[model samples]
Target: MSAGRDDDAQGAGAPGDAARPKVSSVLFLCGMNAIRSPIAEALARSLLPPTVYIASAGVRHGERDPFVDAVLEERGLSLGEREPQRYEDLEDGFFDLIVTMAPEAHHAALDATGTASVQVEFWPMPDPSVVTGSRDQILDAYRDLLGRIEQRIRQRFEA
Candidate 1:
């Protein structure tokens, strides 16, 4: 969710009112980094300022999905040559927020961060890979997922 500051009792910017801590780094997590999490990471990187660090990881490493690449290309975004990474493979383990799009990822994040001050949020996104149909219908499912992720990123990060 969007990080917000509480106004001072006196006024909006009264003296001695410390601003709330902003989310400087975020991790988008899912069962497989191939789709949802990667999409979120790319969108957040594009939407948020450069000062905000964004990354994505999965509970287990998965092969990159071509559908993800196709949909991202439609929006002028790309993951480049990046491959899906597992949570344990992350180069940097610290983040201000860890947004899990899958139930498994949420559980894993909570378990991994037990007793740590990290914030974890479960977003409950559906897996587009589960949609079996014609090529057009499958692409539509991916597109729908892409739209949902974009909307969520805007709601949670953009002013």
Candidate 2:
């Protein structure tokens, strides 16, 4: 599914509409920190205001993907030697919003934030690693993922 407004009772306008709660902090969650979530975190940092706190984590940690670095570098962004981290590894448990990029992360976020005020959004994205082809083809998949995430972040965060 494409990234859009949270499927909540609140009416949709844009991702940053006044109808939504004020977001001071956001957490991007995925199955592994190696790819989607990290890409999101980097994009958000670049797109959102400096005052907005942004971080990313996974249901479980996985090895850092070099393709992620390549794509981010193409955009002049970087994760700065950051390592993959699990959801449980987050230093601050609370966030105004939690955006999940995978089904497992979405479920994990929902279970972890039961009854809490946090708004969790599921943005279904394909796993680029599953794409088997030439090196260029693999990079293209990563680039596609990067583009989607970047578009979503702009729509959701930019006023």
The number of the candidate with the highest TM-score is 2
Residue lDDT tens for model 1, 36-124: 99999988888889999999999997999999999999999999999999998998999987888888888898778876777676777
After superposition, the stretches of candidate 1 with alpha carbons farther than 4 Å from their true spots are 1-20
Off by over 4 Å in 2: 1-16
Native-vs-model 2 lDDT?
0.85
Candidate 1, after superposition: displacement of residue 104 in Å? Answer: 0.5
Clashes of each: 0, 0
What shift in Å separates residue 114 of candidate 1 from its native position after superposition? 0.7
Candidate 2 residue 159 Cα shift, in angstroms, is: 5.7
Candidate 2, residues 52-116, lDDT tens digits: the string is 99999999869999999999999999999799999998889999889998889988988898778
lDDT of 1: 0.81
Q: What does candidate 2 score on TM?
A: 0.90
